[model samples]
Target: MPQATVMERTPFIKPNPASTQAAAVSDGSRIGFENVSVTYGALTVLHSFTLTVNPGEIVALIGPSGSGKTTALRAVAGFVRPSSGRILIGDRDVTNLAPYDRKIGMVVQNYALFPHMRVDENVAFGLRAHGASEDLIRSRVPECLSMVGMSAYAKRYPRELSGGQQQRVAIARALAPRPQVLLLDEPLSALDAQIRRSMLDELAKLHRDLPNLTVLYVTHDQSEALTLANHIGIMRDGRLQAFGDSKALFRHPPNRFAAEFLGRANLLPVSGLKPADEGMAQVRFGGIALSARNHHGLADGSDCLICIRPHDFRFSRSAAEPNSVSGTVLSVQWQGDVHNITLNIGGEALRMSCPPMTNPPGLGETVSVHFNPAEVTLVPEDGARG
Candidate 1:
């Protein structure tokens, strides 16, 4: 776990539901968790969880299992009562509302479609539960199925379709009621890798089609989060470790845990920090005066870490990249399209990923990797101490 840093740069637009949901609709389409917490007996499962899912935006809560990401989703679904604080859909307080009262569409990992019912029937069930008219059910069911590209499978039973098809039906069922809020809990985890990738594309397309739909997506897969979410919240041990726009969070991680979890990061111990040109800062790393973005604003001469992605370390230098590190080639591996090289620099291991090279440094050979200062980011080394 890492010491937390508040990361949202812009205020999230709020949630809004259908006009029929007078009890749930307030202003816009958004979800707000106000210091919500959940505890069972002596153990706390969620700790003051708070975040906003803006209108038409997808926010993914990603972390290792048991980190309370699912618990946070359930709280919004009204399946878990918060021990304190409030939950709101739009401006309406939903903390005390029943699950049925919230105009929310939910898709879970298991696909939750009725095995005995046809795809069309499953999609109509939600509409019926809300007491919609027969005409509306007939039209909405087909529209939702079509939205998920499952219109052709309307008459097929859940067992008759493939895993991907079943998941599509589940999504259609969730979307049938025209809910403004969509909660997805690892919705693509049941499918194979190929199907999962396809579903990610489908989901992105679905969101584009329904621009006003706000989504709260929970997953343990970081890649899924990065591919689908506009903003990502990294959680650990029942707390949010970091949150920001996907690219900014990945490009400039705030702490050690976030840096390593969101993507590949090569962190090196550094101190003697001092301001450099423009927004960059300088630090000392094994006699190398490295320059990087001091994201945490760590003071001068303070111990911190600089994070460099493996792909950012270049095999050759240019005029723009003045920082270079020399090391002994410990391992060189050709991983299909790229080469993964492990270097030993002053007893510390530094990894570099480069495009397929015609000539790679052999084992025990001295080599140097150059990186631009703009590609380096400083992170607070307050967590991930292993």
Candidate 2:
């Protein structure tokens, strides 16, 4: 086995600790998995998936359990091989390369540091194996430790450190060699909320410092993907559902599943479409005419589903208005910053989130609800559900 080695310090101050200058095979740092499919016997884990990680970009793969998010990360790490397709790092074809040969840094949620070693020793483990000069290892370990804000805990053992601290050590260890790509598999899932928040900040700072490093981050947490990733690839049942900028995906999801899966949504089944003024359409939602943004793909008098985010709906007085509905308040509950109000409309329960309003309506009372036409989306009703 090839030993991991730490880098030699040249004593240069980082203008931005979030950027990296690591280069990959082709010309710069890029990871591409084209038509990548992995199968185990008769079962296929990944299917004809194509993804690219541009240099210095952070892309997150998010999905539910058994969605193959981790499988994709492992494929890039060389921990698993594709039955077909190509895996390229920079300009190099590394489809068959060993994991250690790829020079990629990997951090899992477990923070798998060596139990017997101190923080500094664990960070230096890779460098020592790669036969780095003792002087280089000695000087680089502290630098890497400081990079993760774990320099003060160098003397502590893995058992002595908190989950977040141990995770930082793991990150420092992976980064010791200055790899071209960093793959994180739910790295914050194990930490408490406060620590996770801090670690997220540190990770974001690191991204700003490493300008040339490509990152492939896998997580099931939507908030993590939304906050940390420049782009996101949503996965479901071992297939890519949608991939694009985080804002774009959240603002205009391609389908109902994408909308509901990415965040809380009120997906209302529809029956027809009619022209409404002002670049909007009067969508015939079952027994209701709702004004919505124009959805070119939804033909006139065609059945579809309207996806409205819970946060987009607002409560109003019980009165008929365009793009509004009247319903009996089913229940209301306090959720710290907001109130989750459930409304019974046409025998269906619709949930909406609103800021804690003064003198909220009582349950069993009829109330009016309004949603912005621009925020209401139209998707094919038949195939909207998975």
Candidate 3:
């Protein structure tokens, strides 16, 4: 990996105890957007969105293009002023502050390195802009580069380095100012898959080294958000759909958009649902009665969708088993460690992931798939927020 190569060039710098204490004395690095909104004339880009990012936490905002994830990040950076509400960093209001005055660092998707400048000069740009002394800039430049494991390439120009190396320079430049918060706007989107994965590890390590640095990352990639974020905020059509810990949100999404966005979900339409024993629901799908854990306020005879992850289904030997559905295997795809089996059950296609070591039914073969009731989640059919 490029970061590993850079790490080999210099010893990792540990944060000094005294410096840590000084940095934490007034640690107001937490970020909050209270009922914020942004508009461009008649079109609203961000709705009345509100979320809080804890100090030193990495919060990834994820959604499709035009979903307002980037707009929220830009609001925090002070590039686009909010049309309503306020933005807070720690306890101070930064809603009206200029981008540079906000003391925030941003790394854009393109890396945005100056082509003509050497890496060291690029890393020194932020410090110089903030009017740091010459000696301080000199000392900080090498330290930032070293943190990113790019100190040895400080003399090289952007054109002379590979894509991964250039990204490291961009990150080093952002960190040089020692801003209270870091905003990453799809910083790894330009790289290839392997390089992107390597850089993700590097960013996680960088966060560990800088414990007080709060990060608000924006990306449309679900895997990136799941892997790097402590909390994830899902957005669509300018509205904040859901916000919670990455794992919890993925496991128990509040709405259909969130369930479908975060990962692959089998959203099966169910009817004739009634309250059963122990906070469970009995629902009928394709004339078969099945039990599922009920958390949503589903009334008797109400129709809803049942959400079950692909991995939650297992291959059953017979259709007589509880919560079993008989189907024909439409396709079987080998995905390295597991096989993804697509089954056509009563005209509906359901996907299930099976371990490669286990025997998955061949294509065009009849099969029975089973899932435990506890693994199922019920979502409202209308999907209207109550």
What TM-score, over all chains together, does every model reach?
A: 0.91, 0.89, 0.89
How accurate locally is residue 341 in candidate 2, as Cα lDDT from 0 to 100?
A: 92
Sort order, lDDT high to low: 3, 1, 2
lDDT by residue for model 2 (171-279), tens: 9998886777889999999888999889889999888776666889999889888888999999987789889899878877777668888888777777768766765
Off by over 4 Å in 3: 1-27, 318-321, 357-360, 384-386
Expressed as tens digits, the lDDT of each residue in 33-123 for candidate 1 is: 9998888766777899889888889999998888899989888887777888889888789887767767788889998778889989999
lDDT per residue for candidate 3 within 1-386, as digits (tens), equals: 01100012111122332231113312688999999888877777888889999888999999989999998998888767787888998998988766655667789899888899999999987776665677878788899899888989989999999888899999998888677888999999999999999999999999999887899999989999999999999998999988998988887777788888899988889999889888899999988898887776778898888888999999787777779989999999998999998999988899999789556677799988899898878877665422
lDDT of 3 at 150: 92
**Positional deviation of 294 in candidate 3, in angstroms?**
1.7
Assess candidate 1 and give its TM-score to the true structure: 0.91
Which residue runs of candidate 2 sit more than 4 Å off their true CA positions? 1-27, 275-279, 317-322, 382-386
Question: How many residue pairs clash (N, CA or C atoms closer than 3 angstroms) in each of the candidate models, in the order given?
Answer: 7, 23, 0
Best by TM-score: 1
